[model samples]
Target: MDEARWIQQARAGDVESFGRLVRAYQTAVYNLAYRMLGDRMEAEDAAQETFLRAFRHLDRYDPERPFRTWLLSIAAHHCIDRLRRQRPDLPLDPGYLGDEDPDPEAALIRKETRETVQRLLRHLPPTDRAVVVLYYWYGESLRGIAEALGLTVSAVKSRLHRARWRLAQGLEATDEV
Candidate 1:
């Protein structure tokens, strides 16, 4: 069935329809949370919270927009909120996620690169990091990002450019070190 039909069914108290939506989106949501939080356990918690929020607010969703986009918007908000609450003392370690690849050499290189990027990303403001992750890691288009982030397309594009520049500058500094 189409998403609209599934959403309509879910809205009408069809648990199975909602479950189908959840099953379809669980991975993407988890991946986004994981990338944002950098801890599997925290990511799991965020993912759960995302779904809970989505379910609770399902009635409020505008059917004109894509359901997945709506769902991700919720997830992104939850992750950013979580980050804010911890912003005082906690530092974002970009390499906190690390590499899962099995090849030793490849894994080592990947870890190093990820760590470097993470370190750079840590220095960036969370807003910039959020844009970079959503744009680059999630492959969200500017329009999708605008919808997910509740920003204008121009704003998202500007932020992405600044974030990329900040990341590049940080990496350059790391190389000097």
Candidate 2:
């Protein structure tokens, strides 16, 4: 994809180059937003804001780091801010699941599990939620998460531990219901 060339051109004020970059990363940015915000519309908005911020701060980006990491860092911070502002208790959209599951019962179980996880995620603080999403769903290493979230590796580890404990507590509480 000649990402370096595109980034160079984009830095030189080539809008088309920037557009290509957006198209390349749009789905990733949107998925991260959707997972963090738990609402399609809000996620869309957050993704747009993340790109806008990225464009505005392209000069600040370090070429030494992977562009995807930098882009997702912007997204994570934006979602965290949006979450902090409203803290909505919106339900996860069931439509997120694909129809590829041929077994109806298994599909139902997966849907229920997804909903339960999303519900538990909603109870976490915004930063903690971001840490959990980036770590588990994105399969990010502790160092990667720490870089993305602007935290120390130790802080990321602590948040993951705390988030797991809280999620376990949430599960127990739900089980009693």
Candidate 3:
């Protein structure tokens, strides 16, 4: 698929071209939302909103920058805004597991681990959580995360460092329980 051509067409008021872009990036956008919000429904909503915002603001998009980066930037900011509106201490629902694993024991362990990680992530400030999620889950570089989240590179590094410390503390507390 020629992403540049699609982007150009989308900019020229072609809805189908935009739909193709959405199909290509939906999983990435939704996964960022899911990791940030820790709720399947909210993540889905955020992903839709991100695409809507992107479509509306296509003219503002700089062609020199990567389209995926720009899209994820919108998703990250939307999730951060949503997080800010809600109570910080609200319990995170682990949501649902994916397809059944052939090994039941392994599946259970993986579920438990995912739940634990989500719980720990819930403690982070929204921006810090976004930094960690983009860095770890998406394998985004520090510079990429900085661009995505509108933070300076040093700020991104600081947030990542602080988030790790907080997550480690959370793990220790859970271990003691």
Candidate 4:
């Protein structure tokens, strides 16, 4: 069944339908959590918590909005909260730890790239990090990101611009080092 059908069934307390929804979105939710939290165990915990919250609030979900967007918003918000609470130290490698490449060199390059990006991301505030993750990693539009993060579109735009500039300056500095 499609997302809508599954959602309707889930709202009706169909365990199987909700299981389908979980199956469909687990990887995406996990990836978002991982990106924001930068720790494998923490991300997994956050993702599980996200799904639990989503299920509890499923009745409040608006069908007019995309289901994945709603779910992602939940994951993003949860990860942001976690980030604020822990405020972990930087240089967290934010790669999809589950991924594997056939070539060792390619894998090494990807690992380095992820480490660089995560280092850049660590400098941003939680809200700015959320904006970057939602926009760049998830392909969310400005409006969509704003809605997901409860910010105005202009605010989202400003954050994105500032965050990108910070990343650029940071990368430039690293290049000189």
Candidate 5:
């Protein structure tokens, strides 16, 4: 069944239908939450909360809207709220979430690069991080990002600009250091 049919079934209290939706979107939802929260445990919790909230308010979802976008919006808003309630700077273990590959050297380089970027991203305010992640990591268009973030397109552009500038300055300082 298509997403619409599954959504309909889920809305009508079909556990199997809901399970399918969760399975289909779990990786994507988890990735978004992880990128937004910068902590695997916190992202897992946030993703669960995102799905629970979505299931609870499925009726409010507009059928005309894309389901993935709607789902991400919930994740984004949940992450933003959580970030607001906590400090953005919580130190992460350097060895956490290491990626392994056939070529050890290449894998090490990739891991270091990713760690650097994620570390810098942690310095950004939540909404700015959300906009940058959606626009760059997800390759979402400006208008699409605006919708996902519940922000105006202009606001999305401004946030992206400011975030990019901040990231540039941050990376520059890291280079100097």
Candidate 6:
């Protein structure tokens, strides 16, 4: 079935349809959450919460909009809310406590890059960071972001552009220093 058809079925209280929808988008949603939250456990929790919230609000979803966008918005809001409530002093490795990567060098590089971006993201306000993550990291479009955040499309575009420029400048400054 098409996404809209599944959405419609899910909205009408079809459990199987909803499960199918969840199966289809679970990885993307989890990956997005994991990147934003920087903790595997929190990401999993957030991803679960996103689908739950989306399922609860399924009736309110406008079928004209993409289903994934709607679901992602829920996950983003949940992750941001959690981040706001947490203490910054605590360590950020939220996944398996002692998990080792198979490729140590490549893993180290990825971990370092993630740490750098997370550090930079911490400097941004939640809304700006969400825009940056959704647009640049997750490849969400202006319209998708706007729908997700309940912002105007123009506002989403402007915020995304500004966030990208700021991140670029930050990287350049780091390179210089």
lDDT (0-100) at residue 150 of candidate 1?
86
Q: List the residue pairs that clash in candidate 3.
A: none
Model 6 alpha-carbon drift over 4 Å, by segment: 94-103, 165-177
Off by over 4 Å in 5: 93-98
Q: What are the lDDT scores of the predictions, listed in order?
A: 0.80, 0.88, 0.92, 0.89, 0.88, 0.80
Clashes of each: 1, 0, 0, 0, 0, 0
Report the C-alpha lDDT of model 5 over 77-176, residue by residue, as the tens digit.
9999998997655766363364568998998888888778887787689999999888877888999999988899999999999999999989998889
Which candidate number maximizes TM-score?
A: 3
Report the lDDT of model 5 for residue 21: 96
The whole-model C-alpha lDDT of candidate 6 against the native structure comes to 0.80
| Per-residue alpha-carbon lDDT of candidate 3 for residues 9-95, written as tens digits (9 for 90 to 100) | 999999999999999999999999999999888889999999999999999999999999999999999999999997777667765
| Cα TM-score of candidate 3 | 0.95
lDDT of 2 by residue, 55-104 (tens): 88999999999899899999999999888787375556664636567998
| Clash count, predicted structure 4 | 0
Worst 10 residues of 5 by lDDT: 91-100
TM-score of each: 0.83, 0.90, 0.95, 0.93, 0.94, 0.79
Off by over 4 Å in 3: none
| TM accuracy, model 6 | 0.79
- lDDT tens digits by residue: candidate 1, 74-119: 9888888887876445555445444478899998898887666657
Misplaced by over 4 Å in model 1 are: 88-102
Model 5's alpha-carbon lDDT is 0.88
Clashes of 1: 1
